[model samples]
Target chain A: MIGVELRLMLRRRRVWLCWVLLCAIPALVAVLLAVTNLAPAPGQGGAFLSAVTSDGQLFPAAALALVLPVFLPITVALVSGDAVAGEASTGMLRYLLVRPVGRLRLLTAKLVSVGAFVLLAVVFVTITSYIVGVLLFGFGADAAVGGAGGITSLSGVVLTPLQLAGRTAATVGYLALCMLAIGAIGLFFSTLTDSPLAAALGVLAFVVVSAILLPLDAAAGIRFYLPTTHWLAWIDLFRDPILWRAVREGVFVQLGYIVVAFGAAWANFATKDVTS
Target chain B: MAGQRFSRRWLLVAAGAAAIVGVSAVQLPAAALDVDAEALRRCIRAEVPPYVGYAEASGRLGLPEIPQLESVTTLLTTTTRIRSYVAGADRWRADQLTGALGDSERDTYHLGAAEYVWDFGGNQLTRVLGQAPLRLPRAGDLLPPDLARRMLGLAPGDPVTAIPARRIAGRDAAGIRLVPTDPDTTVGRVDIWADPTTALPLRVEIAARTGPTLLVSELLEVTDGPPDPAVLRPVVPPGAGAVTASAADLSGALRDLRAPPAPARLAGRARLTLPSTPGSDLPGVGVYGTGLAGFVLIPTGRDVADRAVDGATAAGGTAIPVPFGRAARIGTPLLSVAVRSTGRRGSLLIGTVAADVLQQALLELPARGRPS
Candidate 1:
C-alpha cells in the first residue's frame, strides 16, 4: 500500500515541479555568485554563503541554509496538506475506503508518502546544488595548494571530504525529521477539512505563527514547544566537536512533534466522517 | 466499534497531556540544601572539578556605546549564552552563541596558556598572544563560574551571609550573599548559588544600591565531569584564515600610548600596582584602592578621549569642571566612567564607584608631561 501511494505521488506533476523549483533556486544563486564574483560578507546573508565563494564544496550547506527557512517548509506543507484532503476533494477518498482499505492503513500510507516526498526534496536539492556549486566554482583553489581537499567546519577545523559527506548526510537526516514533523501537522490539518487548499493554508498558518513567535522574548516561555524553535539546530552539526546540546534538544522536540501530531492525526482521522 | 474509537482518541490526547505534565514535573523545585555560608564560599574559591555546562549571562546596565568599545558595551548590556567546558584552570572552552537564530557562534579555547578564538561567521581562527595589562571585557568573563569567582575575589572583606538555598539547573544549590560596606562602591549586594557537593557556581546575581539587579549569570544545565579533551584543543583548519594577535589588540585605546605618572593617592585611596607579567606593564595605567570600591586609570589617545567624552555626554553624562581640557562622567547603577582630556593626552577613570568618586579621581589625575 505504501509503495502504491509513493508511486501515485511520483506520478503527480506538482511534486516534480516542486523539486525542480527547489533545485533551480540554488543553481541560480550559484550562477549569480559566479558571474558577480562576490559573496555576502561573513555574518550576513545565509549561513555558509560567505565561505562558498572560496570553497564550492561547502555550497550544499549554503544551499540548505538558503531554502530551509521558508521555501522547503512550504513545499512540505503543500504536499502533506494535500495527502488526504486532495483525495476527498477529488471524490476519491470515499471510493478508496469502500475498497476494504482500513482507515489506519490508509492514513499510514499517506504519512509514509509524505515522508518520502520530504526526503526526496531535501536529497535532490543537496545533490543538484553540489553539482551546480562544483561546476561553477570548482573544488576550491586552496584544496589544490594545501593538498587538504576538504571543507572547513564552522569551528575552523578541516573536515575531509569523507567527513563532509558524513556531516551532510547527518544534516539531511536531521532536516528530514524536522520536515516530517511539519508534514504530520499538515496531515492533522488535512484530516480536519475536505478542501486541499484550506488544509494547506492551515499548515502554513501554523508554521507562520510558530516562526513569528520563535524569536520574540515575550514568547520565550512557550518557545521551547514551538514547532519552528529547533528548525535551525541542524547548523550545530557543522561545529568542530559537534555541539550536541541543541541538536539533542532538537531531536527530542521534533520527535515529540512527530508523535503528538501523528497521534492527533490518527485520533481525528479514525473517527472522522467521510461525507465527501 | 464507534465507542472504542472514541476512547482511543481520548487516550491519545490524554497521553499528550501527560507528557507535558511529566516534563514540567521534572522542573519542580528541589528541597533546600543545608550548608554553612563560609564553607560554601571557601569551596567556591577552591579549585573546582572539571565540568561542562551551558550558561547564560544577562545585564541591564544600559551602558552607552563607545567608539572601538561596542563589543564590550554589548557584553555588559545584553544577554549572552555560552557553552562552557572546563577541564582545569588553563584548559577550557567557552563558545558564545550569537545571532537571534543561533546561526553564528564564537568559541574561545584556552589550552594551557595559549588562547584561540574561532569565529563561526567568518570562519576565521585567531591565536591570541600575550596578556594585556588592561583589556576590554569579553563574553568569557561573564560565564557563571568565572564571574562568581571574580566577584568573590573582589569583595573578600565584605560580609558574607547565607541566603536560602534554591534549586538551579536541577541541582540543590546552596546560596551566599555578599553585602559591601564600602560607601564608595555602588554595588549593594551580590548573590551566588553553587552546587553543594562540587562547589561549582550555578548562578550569580549582582544588584546595585539604588536599582534592580544589574547583572545575572546562571548555568541552565550542567554536568560534572571532564569534557572531551579534543573539545578544548582548537585545530586550525588549512585554507581557513588564521592570524596571531596580541591581547592589547582587544583594547584599541591602550595600544602604543604613553601618559604622565599617576598620583600616589586618588580621592584619598592609595594607588594599587596592577599584577602583570613584570615587563608588560603599560606604564601610565594605575589602579586605585582595593576591593569593590576602586577604579582604574587608563591613558588614552586624545582623539579617543574626546570621542568618549562626546559619546558619554550625549548619553546623559554630566560635565564636570576640571583644570585640564574637559571632563565628563557617565554613571550607571553599577558602573561609573569619567573621561578626562588633558592637553595632548587624556585618561579614563572607571569603576563600580559612584559618579562623585570617579569625578574626584579624575581631578587627582596628573596632567600630561608632568611629574606627580
Candidate 2:
C-alpha cells in the first residue's frame, strides 16, 4: 500500500514540477551571483546566500534556508493536502474502504508516502545546489570568514570539510522532520474537507499567518508554541559546538503538532461516511 | 458544507493567534522602557570634575606605544602624524609631526585665536587670523575631564543605566552604561566611571558589539593643584622662517572640511539629525539616533583612497574596491582607521562601528549624496 501510494505521488506531474522548481532556484541564484559578483544587502534573501560569494560550500545550506520558509512548505502542503481529500472528492475513498483496508492503515500508508516525497524533495535541492555551486564557485575551506577576515563562529574555530558536510546533512534531516508537522496539518485539513484545494489553502493560511506575526514583539511570548518559530532553528546545527537548546525545543514543538494534528485527522476520518 | 466546518476551525485558530499577540503587546512596552538613557547621562554629567589637577598617565593605544619623556604619541594613529600636548584650557600646542625617521615637526600654538605654527620640519612658520585651527583632545582633556564631556554630549537616544560603583584612578566612582539604541551601530556599549565628588568621568571604555574593548582612556594619577605655568608656554627654536597665510587661503584649504551630510537612517535603526558646520580645527560632526553612535570625518587633505589601498596592503587587510573609490581597515582598536578618499580630498571615517561598517558607509556615501 505504501509502495502504491509512493508511486502515485512520484507519477504526478505537479510533484515533478515542484522538484524542478526547487532545483532551478539555487542554480539561478548561483548564476546571478557569479555574473554580478555583488552580494545582497543585509537581511535580504536567504540568510547565508550572500556568503556564497566568499565560500561556495555554504550553498546547499543557504539554498535550503531560502526555500524552507515558503516554497518547501507549500510543496509539502500540495501533496499532503491531497492525500485523503483528493481520494474522497473523487469517490475513491469508498472503493478503498471496501477492500478490507482499515482507515487507520490507509492514513498511515498515505502519510508514509507523503513523508517520502518530503525527504526526496529536500535531498534533490541539496545535491543540485551543491553541484551547481561547486561548478560556479570553487569549494574552499569551511572556515567561515565574515566580511574581510573576521571569524563568525561562537567558538571562533573553523570546521573541517567533513564536519561541515556532517552539519549540513544534520540540518537537512532536521528540516525534513520540521516539514512533517506542516504535512500533518495539511492531512488534518484534508480529512476535514473533501476538496483538496481547500485543504492546501488551509495549511497555507496557517503558515502565512504564523509568518506575519513572527516579527511582532507582542507575539513573542507565545511564539515558542508556533511551528513557524522553529523553522530556522536548523541554522544552529552549523554553529561550533552546536547550540542544542533551540533545536531541541523546535523538535519537541513540531512533534507535539504532529501528534495532535494526526490524531485529529484519524478521529475525523474514522467516522466520516464516504458519500463522494 | 465541509468548507463551513473548516471555516469555523480557521476562525478559532485566528482568534487564538490574535489573543497571543494582544497579550504580548500589553507586556513588551513595559519591558522595553526598563532603561532610561537620559537619566543615566545626567547622572554621569553631574559627576565629571570641573578641573582635573596635575595628572600623569600611560596606557597602550592599540598594540604599539612610542614611549616619550614629557609626552608620548602612539604614532598619532593617522598618516598625517598630527600630535598635540596640552597642559590646560588656555595653553596648548599641536605639532604636525612628520617624517618616518624623526625627520621634522611643525609646532602650532593656539592662544585665544592667535595662531602660530613653526614648521621646523618644513623650515617655515605660518601665522593666520580668523582661521580656527583644529584641536586634538589634550592629554589633560584625555583624563576624566574630556572623555566624560564627550560621553555626556552624546545624542540622546542611547539607553543609559547606572551599574555598580567601582574604584577608578584611585577615586571611588559610579559607573554608567550607555547602549546604542540603533541596532545597526557597531558600538556594543560604552561604560563611564565618574568621580563621586566631582561627577566627572574617571575612566571611559568604548566596546564593539562583538564584545571587545576597543578604546579606553583613564588617568593613572592626578594631583590636586595646577601644573607649573611654564609648562603651558610654546617655545620655538631659532632659525625657523616665518610666513603669513591669507584668510582666503585658510577658508579654501578648509572648504572640503565640512561635515558629511546626515544619513536619513543609520544601519536602518537610528534616525540622524542635520549635520552641523565644520568646527575650527575639527572636521564634520555626524550624529545618529540621538547620539548613541556618531563619527567625526576629519579631512586629511591627502588622497584618502590611495591611503586606504596602501594601508590595506600593509595591514594584511582586504581592500574592498567600491564604485566611488576604495576603502580599507588600517589598524585595530584605538588606532583603527577607515580611509575613504576620492583622491581630491579624503576624510578618515572614524567611529565605534566595526571595520566593515565603516567601509560600507564610506563606499555608499558618495553615491547616496549626489542625484543622477
Candidate 3:
C-alpha cells in the first residue's frame, strides 16, 4: 500500500515541484536575512541595523507570517486533495480496491506520506528562516523584552548557539501542529472528493476564515478554539515565564481535530462502495 | 461534500474575525502625557537644591582700643542664590534660604563665589583681583533625571520665603529681614528674619516638597539680601578699612568662595571662563555697575585696576543693577550686564556671573559716587 501510494505521488511530480517552488519566497527571505545581517551600505548601515534590531520582539510573529502562507493547511490541502482524485482520474482506485487489502489502509498510507511532507515542510521553514535571520541580523548575545511588565531581558545562556536554536525551534515546532491539523482536514477532504480542485479550495477556505476570525472581539471567548490562534501561541516564548498553557491547549485542539478527521475519514472510506 | 460545507462556514468565520480585531484595537488604554510632564517638572524643582549666594566676614565699624586699625570690615557674598536667599540675607538670622530653585539641577552642581573686592585705608594700599570674568557651573552638575529622583512626589506648587531674625553677622547686629517662597508648593508660610537699622529682612526660608516636610525642622533659607549692586561688579573702596594683600592671599582669605579665580576686583588679575561657551576667552576684564548717581562700567583689569565699582550706586537711595550677559541692560534686581565683545569662542557676560559675589564686592565700592 505504501509502495503504491509512493508511485502514485511520484507520477504527479510537476504539481509537487510547484509546491516546493511556492516555498521559495520564505526560504529565500530566510537565506538573505542570514547572510547580510540586514546591514545596508555603510551610509545606511546604522539606520538599517537599528530597524532590524527593533524587530527583536517581532521574531515569533515573523516566523508565523512566513509559515502561514503556504507551509500550512494550504500545502496540506494541495497534497491530500490530489490523493483520491489523482488516483481515480488515473483509473487506478478501482484496481486497488479489487485486492484483498483494506481500502482504509491504502488511504491511511497515503495520508501518512502527505503528513510527513507537511511536517518536513514546516520544520524546514522554521529552521532555515531562523538560521538565515540569525546570520543576517547578528543575534546580539541577548534579546530584550519590554512592555506591560516593564523591561525584562534574556538570551543565549552560553556557547550553545545550538541550544538557543533548539529552544526557538521548539516554539516553531509547537506552531507546526496547527499546520498538521489543517493538513488532517485536507486529508479528510481529499478522501471524499473526486476533484483535487474542490478538496484544496475547501481547505483554503477554512484557513482564510480562521485567520480572519481569530482576533475578532465577537468570538473572543471561543476564538482560541481555532487553529490560527494557536499558530500564534508560539509568541508565548517571548512572554515572561513563557506561558505554555496556550501552546499546550493548542496541541490538544490540533490533536482533537486530527483524531476526529482521521476517525471520520476511516469510517467513511471503510463503508463507501467505490466499485462503480 | 465536506468541502462545500466547510467553505460556507469558513466564509462566515473570516468576516467575523476582521471585526474582532478592529474593536480590540480601539479598546486599548492610552497613557496620560501631560500629567507625567508636570510631575517631572515639579521633581526637577524640588530635587535640585536652589542655587545660593553667601558671604561671611568679621570686623569693627570704628577705632577700638585693641584694634591695630581704625576700622575693619570682612565682607563676603555669593550668587549661588535661591531668589529668596537674597531676601534671607536681609533678614536677621545669617543662615537661611527661602524660594524656588533654578530648574537646571538635573545633575550634581555647586555654586561658588566667583568674584570678590577688598579695601584698606590706613596702609594707603589697594589691590584689584580682576579675573577674565567667567563662572558657569560645570555641566554634569545639574542632570534633570537625578534631580527628579531626588524630588519625586513633591507637594504641588512648592514655594518658600526667607526673612531676617534678631542675630546679625554671627553676633548681634541689626537692620534686615528676608522671605523665601517655594514656587513648587503654596502650603507653608514665608520665613522671616529682620534687622532694625536698615529695617531690611536678613533671611528667608521654605521647604521643598520632596526633601523637607511641612513641619519646621528642615526649613532652609538665605541669610542676607538686597546686595549693593557693586557686590558682584568687583571693586574695593580707598578709605574704608586697614589692610593689604596679593590676589593670591585674597583667594585664600576668601576660601569659602562658591566660584573660583573670583571675578577680578580690588585684589589682582587673571583670566576666567564663565562656562559661557566652549571657546570663550575674554581678554580685558572689569566690573561695571550703576549706583545712586548713574551706571558706570569701570575697567578693572591690570592697567586701569586702580578703582572698583559696586553694582549699586548709593546716594540717598541705592540703585541696584542686575547682570545679564545675554544683553547689557542694567537696572534694579539684576537689570543686565552686557557682554563686552565676542572672542575666541564667546564674549564676557557681566551679569551672567553670579551676583551674590557682587554683594560682597559692595563693601569695596567707594562709599558711592567716588572718582574712578
Q: Each candidate: what lDDT? A: 0.83, 0.61, 0.39
For B208-310, candidate 2 gives per-residue lDDT tens digits of: 6664665566653444344345433443322224577743345432345344443444433343443333343333433333354454344444443465457
lDDT of 2 by residue, A1-276 (tens): 888888898899999998999889878988999999987643356766655665576678778887888899899999899999999999998898899788878988888888887888889999898888777876543333322212222122345666666777788778888888899889989998999999999999999999898766568577777898888777656544465555787887787777667767776777677887
Each candidate structure's TM-score, on Cα atoms with residue i matched to residue i, is 0.86, 0.46, 0.38
> Which of the numbered candidates is closest to the native, going by highest TM-score?
1
Instruction: Give the per-residue lDDT of model 3 (tens digit) for A171-219.
Output: 6566556766777777777677767789889889988888788646567
Question: Compared with the true structure, what per-residue lDDT tens digits does model 1 show for residues B77-165?
Answer: 88887888999888899988875456677899898779889886766788988787777677888988898888899887777998988
Error of 2 at B128 (Å): 38
Candidate 1, A1-276: lDDT as tens digits: 889999999999999999999999988999999999989877678877877888887888889888888889889989999999999999999888888778889989999999999999999999998988888877764464444447666766677777788889999998989999899999989998898888889988999999899767678788888878888888888777677777787788887888788888888888878987
Error of 1 at B171 (Å): 4.2
Tell me, by lDDT, which candidate is best.
1
- Model 3 per-residue lDDT at A100: 88
Q: Lowest-scoring 10 consecutive residues by lDDT in candidate 2 chain B? A: B63-72
Task: Go through the candidates in order and give each one's DockQ.
Answer: 0.44, 0.01, 0.01
